[model samples]
Target: MNLKLIKGMRIVAATHNPGKVPEIAALLGEDYEILTAGQLNLPEPDETETTFTGNAMLKARHAAEQSGEVALADDSGMSVAVLDGAPGIFSARWAGPGKDFAVAMKKVEDRLEEIGATDRAAWFTSALAVAWPGGPCVVVEGVVHGRLTFPPRGDRGFGYDPIFIPEGGALTFGEMEPAAKEAISHRTRAFAKLRAALID
Candidate 1:
């Protein structure tokens, strides 16, 4: 079966994170109907996986099973080199749940300082998985390399956007507009790859 997304396809996304919905919708375009876990009233699955790919696949599989439709899932976060790739999958819980991104950001900054990381080298990674109930599954990934900033900037995106200054750009991801951010975001990169893999 062809894996490419066809127009008017009902795509179930395994996430309640509202911030991600718009981006995903934009990529999938108007031809696809995007449904989130919140809309389905599905219980949030525990991210017990150690890697982003594993977590993404887990969510996608679970959602596809529940909805009996093609489901997409993304697991993404910041990976600090100095931190030994820590806050990788735990980036969300770093704030102690409740989805408090602000707390998480502060914690990241504090940890960076504690480690005396002057370079602040870090990368935001996004792993995407798509699964169809009783069908094969696919996975792809993307990353944007950049350095962390002490004080946050702008207010366009969510999570680690404020501090993530993409390489070669002065402004942080949070400083850029939604459309602009998506153009170079890790998710976009991964989706582009996935699209090519399917369509080409």
Candidate 2:
């Protein structure tokens, strides 16, 4: 479907994440005004969809309808090949209600150890959806193959960043600078498709 051209450059982001706002702003360019769902006090919609694309579209449509504005949504997670993608969609939930990645990271490491898994293959997937108040929407998905690192690394980025090392890269996502991470990020890749289809 075609993405409705956003007017007034105002979009309600269907997310409670403050980190995501600036990342999206950078990807979409400075001209667009990105407003977080938290800032707008919009209710965070439940992600009932089985796939990332489904969830992204659900959130985007919910936000667009609730705020009467264009809405953008991202649903992303890390999948471990050895674990059979145990945490694929439950990435955030793995962190528990406290949103503690340290605990989550430990859990991942522990799970790996429990299975005696030597394979470190993993990938991050990001699905993006943009919805207009009128009900039109555009969706895209991106993936970056990588491997998992033990004990996690660095102190930057968020979520499972510390344990993920992109292909041909030595540093984990947490260790890379924002610019470095953004350059090859799953979100950036998804936005690339969105830009080609809508913005470009």
For model 2, name the residue pairs that clash: none
| Residue 163 local lDDT, model 2 | 92
Q: How close is every model to the real structure, measured as TM-score?
A: 0.92, 0.94
Candidate 2 lDDT over residue span 1-200, tens digit each: 45544435798889888988877887888878889998989998888998889999999999999999889999999999989986888899999999998888899899999999999999999999999887788999999999999788999999999999999999999999989998999999999999887787
lDDT of 1 by residue, 1-200 (tens): 87777778888999987766777887766667898987898788888889999999999999999889999999999998898987899888886758887888899888878877786889989999999898878999999999888688888888878988999989899999877788888988998987777534
- Candidate 1 residue 49 Cα shift, in angstroms, is 1.0
Best by TM-score: 2
Displacement of the residue 112 alpha carbon in candidate 2, Å: 1.4
148: Cα error in model 2, Å: 0.7
* Model 1 spans with C-alpha error above 4 angstroms: none
